[model samples]
Target: MRRFYAILVAAGLVYMLFMFLGTIVPYGKADVADRVSAHFLAKDVNSISPTKWVEGDKQVPHSERVYGRKGFEDGSANVVTSIVVNYRSFDTLGEVTVLFASAVGVGLILGGTRRMKYGRKPNFILRVSTGILLPLIILFGIYIFVHGHLTPGGGFPGGTIIAAAVLLLYLSNEEFSLNMIVSKSLEGSMGSLYVIFGLIGLAAGGAFLFNFLPNGVVGSLFSAGVVPLVYMTIGLKVGSELSGVVAEIHEEREG
Candidate 1:
């Protein structure tokens, strides 16, 4: 009976949609006059035409302007990085704050008085392999964040990758533990560095996160003014925060 009612409701909605469209469109075969009327109704009834859509002469898009000027102005090969770190940096900071709050919330909720040792120790082979792989994974994460201004990936994904490497260690070694104090400290420090950079921009250039520094040669490692610096700070902050989140969950599970 419920399904029948739902079907009826869906059918009624479809019927209403078709009826509304029917009112806007002529019902039957049309003469030249009807065809003209229909054309005007569909094309001009909206009170604007393609020619009049914009207020001025067909303008070049802002993105196009950015692309042409990015080399000198932003010094980043990757356009997305320039936008995120230089154009919309405040939003990125807000995102970091939200992630930090979430991590803290998880810790408060899951942390308890008792110590936890849940998973059994893995074999020697697994342990040794993980130990070997861990450094490489961390290095890759660092590379990803460092080259964010020149490449496809950025701080957020690179940081998550680093956290995953840490998680792999936790899974392989039962005794492996994340020091909450150290992780939190690193997270806090990175966050502070990000803010300090913004403050420096404000003091030096009169705007928060202003590109006060020189934009080096495009495609160079040290280019992109504050973009790489901001991304690196974000990478450290995200990596530590996510690692702490996983640690909290692991502790709760083991306890």
Candidate 2:
């Protein structure tokens, strides 16, 4: 009986997938150039462009978007950003949730406020150099996530970079410790803000994580509406969460 139900669910999913695919191009007609990439490139993600069927070709493909076009489905110059933040933002939310869960699991296993147990004290050169370079690394991480709508980097990488700075501190200073209360507060705030933005979008635009803000120039600092904001939230949340996790695992267990 369980097997029968599983088969039924699988079949239903496959049918839905097929229906989705058929809407992309056309039934029984395949156009390699007119695939999903074309829609992304053309900034036609939110709605289907007009289709003109011909004898040989599957459909008249939508022309790729000219650079810096305004008032499209999304205002991001980076096609990947548009897809990730606007077209399918729910998946990004899931990714953040998974990271949060991992952080929680790590905290559960290595639960303590004990200090790190270093083998030897860090030298002056190592300490001084880190002091000089730490701020730069953290700033670079901020740049990555903030410019994620226009550049290659995004929240995950940016947050990881910031967390790396925290790790560097631990390595350089034996007594360095994070205040869990402050860290947890920042983490919770950022996570809540991410969802709050999504909920606000749903109220205004009838879609969760909708790009609710005004569209600015493509490739500009303030463009892509909620993407930069969302990425910023993700960066802070991830950096704090990972910092907590790293701090936890580094602690000297009170045995």
CA lDDT of each prediction against the hidden true structure: 0.75, 0.77
Count of backbone collisions in candidate 2: 0
Using all chains and alpha carbons, the TM-scores for the candidates as numbered come to: 0.70, 0.76
Q: Which candidate leads the pack in lDDT?
A: 2
Model 2 CA RMSD to the hidden true structure, in angstroms:
9.1
Per-residue lDDT of candidate 2, residues 1-255 (tens digit) = 978855754664465456446556466778776554555654543234664323244444333233333443457767787778777788988989999998999998987868967788788898999999999999999999998888898888999999999999988998899889988999988987887787677657756676889777666898877888998999999999999988997886667
The TM-score that candidate 2 achieves is 0.76
Candidate 2 residue 135 Cα shift, in angstroms, is 0.5
Cα lDDT of model 1 by residue, 1-255, tens digit: 978855754664465456446545475655555342322222221222333221135543334333344432446777677767877788998999999999889988986543366556577897889979999999999999999999988999999999999888888878778888899989998987887787677657655667777786667899888888999999999999999888877775432
Candidate 2 residue pairs in clash (backbone atoms < 3 Å): none
